[model samples]
Target chain A: EAGVTQSPTHLIKTRGQQATLRCSPISGHTSVYWYQQALGLGLQFLLWYDEGEERNRGNFPPRFSGRQFPNYSSELNVNALELEDSALYLCASSSRLGYEQFFGPGTRLTVL
Target chain B: QQQVKQSPQSLIVQKGGISIINCAYENTAFDYFPWYQQFPGKGPALLIAIRPDVSEKKEGRFTISFNKSAKQFSLHIMDSQPGDSATYFCAARWGGTSYGKLTFGQGTILTVHP
Candidate 1:
């Protein structure tokens, strides 16, 4: 089976612009997670979606939002992107009843 | 507390030696502890995972030693090889309303020399 997949391996944007990143979870997986790996910040959970509902979120700002589709794919949206937003955004997937998570290659977003 | 503190941000070990990385988490509610390995330009892959119920779990050359009361865990790679050079991360997650959310520690870069 294929692991989690992300699109637009690299994204570029300027300050005040918005950026959208996408992810597709493995088949039979119903839970998707988004994480931001910013420089020196480590990997921080951004959002968690299961069964098309936003389950939980991290301590990120309101600008960071995302949603999961019926197919379990997810999209992470960063509004009013700042230079600090330049980092690798990763998406992970797991069975709704599982604790093991599989991650995607991530989309490297560069904000100027 | 949802923080996982990892020690020795970087590690160097000789081939055929042992590489040890330690991590201490602050949250006692975290029942699942996992270690991840990541190569540059790639996403992290699950190396091993252990629940607090077990003190140790070993797979192949990797071993996870968990200390539930101490809220600490360590990863030991036996007979480490050059191919093991990569970044390693320790993560923790709780259940219930906080399920599906993982708090990862600052990664440790391991460099194995031949």
Candidate 2:
């Protein structure tokens, strides 16, 4: 089976601009998650989506938001991007009942 | 608050030697402990995992020793190699959370020399 896939392998945006990143989960997976790996911050959970609903989110600000489609694909949007927003944004997927999450090659976002 | 703490921000070992990375978590509610390996410019991949119920779990050349009573876990790489050079992360999650909502360590960069 194909693994989780993300589009726009890398992104560049200026300060105060908006950026959107996309992800496609594995064919049979129903749950999608977003994570941000900023410098020195390690991997921080951003959001979780299941059944087309926002299930949970991390400690990030409201400017960091995302949605999951019925097909289980997800999109992460960061508004009013700041230079601090530069980081590798990863997407992962798993079955609704599973604990194992398979991650995709992340989209590296660089905010200038 | 950082729920998970990892020791030795970086590690270096010779080929055929053992590489050890340790992590401790404060949350007892975290039942699933996993180790992830990440190559530069790539996403992290699951290397091995263990639950609180098991004291140890081993895969080819990779082993996870779990100390549930101490709330600590460590990853041991046997016969380390240059191919194993990368950043390793220790993560924890609560059960039944579907996506698992990982709490990750600061990451340990491992460099293996020939």
Name the top lDDT candidate: 1
Query: What is the C-alpha lDDT profile of model 1 across A62-112, one tens digit per residue?
Result: 999998988889999999999999999999999997899999999999998
Clash pairs detected, candidate 2: none
- Residue B74 in candidate 2, Cα distance off native in Å: 0.5
Candidate 1 ranges beyond 4 A from true positions: none
Model 2 chain A: worst 10 consecutive residues (lDDT sum): A94-103
Model 2 lDDT tens row, B1-114: 999999889999999999999999998778788899999988899999998999999999999999988899999999999999999999998655433688999999999999
Candidate 2: tens digits of C-alpha lDDT, residues A36-67: 99998999999999889898899899999999
Candidate 1 whole-model C-alpha lDDT, 0 to 1: 0.93
- For candidate 1, the docking band is high
Residue A109 error for model 2, in Å?
0.7
Worst 10 residues of 1 chain B by lDDT: B92-101
- Candidate 2 lDDT (Cα, 0 to 1): 0.93
TM-score of each: 0.98, 0.97
